[model samples]
Target: MEAKTAVNVGQLSRKPELKPKRKIKWKNVLTYAAFVGPALLFFVVIQIIPFLMGIYYSFTSWNGISAAVDWVGLENYKKIFTNDAKFFNSFWFTTRFMFAAVVISNLLGFGLALLLNGALKTRNILRTVFFMPNVIGGLLLGFIWQFIFVKGFASVGKYTDIGIFKLAWLGDEATAFWGIVIVFAWQTAGYMMVIYIAALQGVDQSLVEAARIDGASNWNVLTKIMMPLILPAFTICFFLTISMAFKIFDINISLTNGGPFNSTESVAINIYREAFQYNNFGLGTAKAVLFFVIVAVFTTVQVVMTKKKEVEA
Candidate 1:
């Protein structure tokens, strides 16, 4: 009987050990929640709440200052779609700018990355100089460019009639659009170059050697081997370019203020004019909602397509 009792006691002790182990798992779960809960709470409170509020207000005729809110139910959207000439024009202009910026910025950044990736003196200093413009505030960049376009160019024009200095850049619609493109490319190229540089560094040295052994030229190795391997970088860069192009405002305002008779007014500038400047808060909010959908859709499509390409590559 005593032997049986000893065996039962041993079983009881083992059972308690297992129970503690189970309780420890719950403790780990609680600990993770404790660490993550604050950030999730902040995200919901600040970002999600405001986003939901913006969507709600878009369907209403709220002047943003008035207490009385009336539901207009897509009237603002209808106006933008059907009757707003300025909105349509701004949309086309911004789309064109987006395409131009993406292509020019990526090409220039990639070229710079290639050049700097080689063995050379002063490459690091050159990188810093190129990236300095990106660190400057967008509004500040705009103002600086405005001075260049309006005053600095004029002075240069008086001194020497050469190198695009004498052209009416901001005063003319065509020139203003290209001027914005050039400024944006200059500011962003350095950033893209850094991304490309990182990707280029990650490429396998052995693969390049193998391609060379097969009598492949430098161009063939770059296009056939290196490009495919760096697809993930391309995905990230493309998405950033698209989103930034869509949301660009401070630079647009500082550079041209959507001027030259609003010919260069981007969608972002147009939305601001509708809301704060014109006091059409509802319409502005509606435009904001539309803008959100457009950006979201574009980003989603690009990600899906590029992610597929990445997987295939």
Candidate 2:
């Protein structure tokens, strides 16, 4: 009887341990879900639902505030491509901006990253200063720069010989386009530089040391070893710049208001004007859908092409 009682007590203790372990496992699973569920829910509500609704609205003539939504199929799309000159013009404008912004921003950013990666007493301070522009609101930056372009430049031009201040930076066709590119690159390059700095730090010190011991020149080492290693950063920067340049609106509106005869008007601005200014929500939504498709296709192709290069490198 005593031996049987001892055996039963041991079994009871073992059963309690097993129960707590199982309960802990379930608690951990629930905890993970609790942490992750909010972000997923927000994404579904804000992004996924609106995206689907935009697609649906693109196919209908709702004017954005009507109880009577007429299904128009592809008429809006057909009109955008065939009848609207502004749509094609804005497309070209966006394409040009993307090309200029991507190339200039990436080059400047890489250069800054290389410079800042070296050990110096003031390097950290400089990096903070450089990245500060990116944190400022785009509309505020545009308005500030617009004032500089209009009033401050004129005063500065009279005093200094830089010649940059003498030109109509945001008032002329050619100058306005280049001006926007310059501002965008200036703001975004530091952000990209930070990314590049992260990537540069990840490069293996052993590889660099081996190259130095092999009597490789600095240029040769950087070009052959570092550039190839940082191809992933290049891919990310290019895609970001491309999308940002294409979607630009606040800066364009605040600085030039698509002035100089709408020469600097972007696709986003065009769509906004179509929807709100002209009250053609169906037409505007159609343009937006096309814009989304074009951006998706281009970004997908670019990522595939660049990723292949990264793999090859």
Candidate 3:
């Protein structure tokens, strides 16, 4: 029995010598490669490579058709900056649109979120209804709204004798601008509401209850207690709206097509015209690069400001 016990002890002590737990470095590497390599390869090939080529082409006079690519050395950029009034007009329009879209969408979204955050029995149904518009394609939404603006409003105005609805919504420059804003805000608000709801859900109800118990008004509780807690949601929503409003394209094209004497052309539409419509690839690439830089700066500033608010909160 003693000898058998001694043999068992020896076996236990030499367990680490079996080498069965050895790491297969190649297997681990291959597993990682299997999961991530394809995505990385595609990103490099599709996005990174094209972006680099665009930068290169921006310095050339490539018409995007001929075999001969001529190097122009900042001439395209010079032309954009010096000779192109339409570019600046589009930029200004885009800037104004972005501001309107961001403010209206975020306000409406947050309002809806607040409304639906209660214990109402119809909250679920209302939420689905609100979010349904976001699922519609931008082009389709544009066309639908176009019909409503042109024909439906005319019919409603005719019957009701309302002068407000009788105005040419899409035919006029100012009204066309507002029309896009209305559509963009309507589409974007629901998506933002969902995000705000998520943020609101994560708040500590106990804090809110305690605040209410302290004889605080509903306004005070909401402004002081709830607002700070869910500020990160504001950051995210603002960022998304800002980016989307700045780069608005499909709906802009499908709805107004930058009509009424090019009053509603976004930078994206301008770049598209320069590249595909006009066949000036180099100039278009330059415009795109410039727009990318501007948007990056703007969004970076907004994000930094919002991040500071979050930290302070």
Candidate 4:
């Protein structure tokens, strides 16, 4: 009887030890919730809720001013697909803009990063100057550049008789498109350069030393060692630029206003007009949903491709 009683007590004592682990687990969960709960709550309330509402709104004919919303099934999507030439035109323009903006901005940013990453007396000053444009609001930046293209360029061309500057930047389709690209690249490159600078600074100097000690050539060290390591920066920069370029709005509005025959109309402007200007909220929401899907897919693919490379590295 005594032996049996001791075994039961031994098992009961082991069970108490398990209770501490359960308490520890619960404590960790509560700690995490305490720290992250507010942000998560805000995100759900602000972002997720609105997004869900937007999705619901896409299926109804809810004019901006109307309290009555009529269920329209997929009619809005149908119209967008079968009859909306303007939307597609906007999509095409945005696509081309995205490509040009992403390429030029990234190249300029990466170049500036490389330049300032080296030992230079004025690098800090240059960094601040470069990043200053990005600090300016997009609307303000657009208006400033519009004046530059319209008045400043004209004056410079008048004196210099430069054919390039003499061209009507905002007054024509081709020039208008490139004008936005130039301004966007100029504004964003500096910001991107900062990101790259951080990533470049983060590279392990010890690894570079090891490579050099192993008789690795400078080019090899840069190509094989540095490039692979800083791949994450490229991922981040490309992702940001792609998203920014695709969903462009303020610059388009202040600079071109989709003028010279609506050549520069972005999907964002198109959706805005559909909702507020034209009062076709349903159609606008549908377009927005589609735009969201396209952007999500594009960014997802980019992240996946870049993440694969990161893994390989």
Lowest lDDT block of 10, candidate 4: 15-24
| lDDT measured at residue 158 in model 2 versus the true structure, 0 to 100 | 85
What TM-score number comes out for model 2? 0.90
lDDT of 3: 0.95
lDDT of 4 by residue, 1-313 (tens): 9999999998988844444333457888999999999999999999999999999999999996878999999999999999999999999999999999999999999889989999999999999999998989889999999999999999999999999999999999999999999999999999999999999999999999999999999889988999899999999999999999999999999899888799999999999999999999989999999999999999999999999999999
Query: Of the candidates shown, which would achieve the greatest lDDT relative to the real structure?
Result: 3
Ranking by lDDT: 3, 4, 1, 2
- Candidate 1 least-lDDT 10 residues: 15-24
lDDT of each: 0.91, 0.90, 0.95, 0.94
Clashing pairs in 1: none
**lDDT (0-100) at residue 66 of candidate 1?**
91
* Ordered list by TM-score, greatest first: 3, 2, 1, 4
Alpha-carbon lDDT of model 4: 0.94
Off by over 4 Å in 3: 1-24
Which window of ten consecutive residues has the lowest lDDT sum in model 2?
Answer: 15-24
lDDT of 2: 0.90
Question: Model 3, range 1-313, lDDT digits (tens) per residue?
Answer: 9999999999988846555677779988999999999999999999999999999999999999998899999899899889999999999999999999999999999999999999999999999999999999999999999999999999999999999799999999999999999999999999999999999999999999999889999999989999999999999999999999999998999889998789999999999999999999999999999999999999999999999999999
All-Cα superposition RMSD per candidate: 4.4, 6.1, 5.7, 3.6
